[model samples]
Target: MSSPKVQLRLNGIRKSFPGKEAATQVLDGLTFDIHERDFVSIIGPSGCGKTTVFNIIAGLVDPDDGVMLYRGQEVESLRGRVGYMMQKDLLFPWRTVLDNVLLGLETKGIDPKRALDTAREYLSTFGLSGFENSYPKMLSGGMRQRVALIRTLVLDPDILLLDEPFSALDYQTRLYLEGILMEAVETFHKTVILVTHDIDEAVALSKRVVVLSQRPARVKAVHDIALNEHSPIAARSDPRFSGYFHTLCAELDIQTRKSA
Candidate 1:
C-alpha cells in the first residue's frame, strides 16, 4: 500500500579516464534510483562503463560530475554502507573458508568470538557447513564463490554491489547460486545493484533491469520484471520470462549495431 523507499540515488553521474589521445568519457549523465530491498540489474554492451558505475558506488573511484544520495541525504560515496562482490571470488588461497569469511569482520575489529559465530551461522545457512576448514584451493568454484558471498554478507552493509559475480560459473552452478543470492537478499533485507552482461540472469534475478548505451554510457531503458516467482529457476518458467528476455536482447542488439 506504501511506496518503496529510495535507498540510493545517482543523479547525472559522469566519469572519464585519461587516454593517450584525450580523456575517454565512460559514463555520461547516468542516473537511476535503487529502492530498499530492491534487486536491480544493470546490463549494457561491453565497455559501457557498468563497472565504472559500480566503482563509483563502492567508493573505489570518484565520478567526474553528479551527486549520489543515500536515503534522501547527499553523500560522496557509500564506502562503509555497501558490500561489493566482483566477478572473481578473490579468495585468498592460503586462508580456510572460515578465515576468508571472517576477514572483513576482523578488519573492522569486531570481537573474534562474535565474528566467528556470525560467520559459522552464515556458512551453515548457505550449506557450506562442512567446508569451514577447507582452503580455497580445496573447494570447487561454486563453493569458493559461496565463501566469497559469505565474506561480503558478513559485513552487514545496507547495499550490495555485485559486478557480474556469477559470470564465470557454469549454468547449473549459476542457477543454484542465484537461488542462494535471492535467499540471502530476502533474509538480510538487502538492496542490490548488479552489473551483468547476461540478459537472462538479469531478468531472473532483478526486480528491475536498467539498460545503458555504449561508451559514455547513459540510461537507455528500465524494465520492471513482473514475474510471479522469486527463485531464478522458477522465474525462468514464468510465461512472462521469455517476453522480458527477448525485449532486453533487442535493446542490447540495437545498441551494439549502432556502436558498430
Candidate 2:
C-alpha cells in the first residue's frame, strides 16, 4: 500500500582528503537510491570517485558527512550483508578453486559439507566445475575471475558491489562473462551496483547507469537500460543504444570542461 522501500540510500555523502594547499573533496554531497534487485552501474571519468562511492556503500570507507541506509534503516553492521568483487581476482594461490569459493562461508562458520554442496551446484554454471581442485595460479584470467565471482556469490549477501570486476579480461572474454554473470544474477535475484568505465558494458549489464562528474563527484545523469529487448551483441549496434552512450559521454565532457 505504501511506497516500496529503498534497498540502499546515500544522503549528502562526502569524502575529503588533505591537500598541500586545501582539503580536496573526492565526493561532494552525492545522494542516490538503489532499489532491491536493481542492477545499477556507476560510470564516470578516471578519478571521479566511482570506487569511493562503492567503498562507502560497502562500509569500507566512512563518509565525512551524511549517512548511508540499508533497507530504510541506517547500516550500522555490514559483516555479512554485502559482497564485494574487485578488479583483481584476489584468489589465494594455495587454495583450490572450490575452496576459494567456499572461503566466505568458512568465515561465517558454515559447515564445510553444506558449503561444498552449494558451491558445487553453481560451479558448472560459472564454467569452473572441472577445475575445482586447481589452484588459482593454474587458471587463466577469466577462470580466476569466475572463482572470485563465485566466492562473492557464495556469501549470499543481500547486495553485491562490483568494482570493475571484468575490466582486467580481454574484450571477448569480458563480453562472454557478462552474460554468464547476468544469468547468475538473475538466478539469484541479487541487488547489484557496479562501477565501470565502459559505457557499452554498463548498457549491457545494468538496469540503470549513474554518471558522475570528476573529483568532488556528483550525479550528472541516470540512464535506464533495457537490453532484454535486444541481444547484448545486437543491442550495442542499435542506433538508440549509441545515442544514449553519446548523450552520457557528452554530459561527462561538459562536466569536465566546467571543472577545467
Q: What TM-score would each prediction reach against the true structure? A: 0.95, 0.91
lDDT of 2 by residue, 1-260 (tens): 67646888888889997899999899999988898889898998999898888877777778889887878888743546789999999998889998898889889899889988998987877767899999999999998998899999888899998999999999988877787787778889898999998877887677788989878899877887766433457667766786677667776673323443
How much does each candidate deviate from the true structure in C-alpha RMSD?
2.7, 3.4
Name the lDDT of candidate 1: 0.92
- Superposed by TM-score, candidate 1 places the C-alpha of residue 93 at a distance from the truth, in angstroms, of 1.6
User: What clash pairs does model 2 have?
Assistant: none
Question: For candidate 1, lDDT tens digit of each residue in 59-113?
Answer: 9999999999999999999987788999999998989999999999999899999
Best by TM-score: 1
lDDT of 2 at 108: 88
Q: Evaluate all candidate structures by whole-model CA lDDT and list the values in order.
A: 0.92, 0.83
Assess the local accuracy of residue 36 in candidate 2 as a C-alpha lDDT between 0 and 100.
Answer: 84
Winning candidate number (lDDT):
1
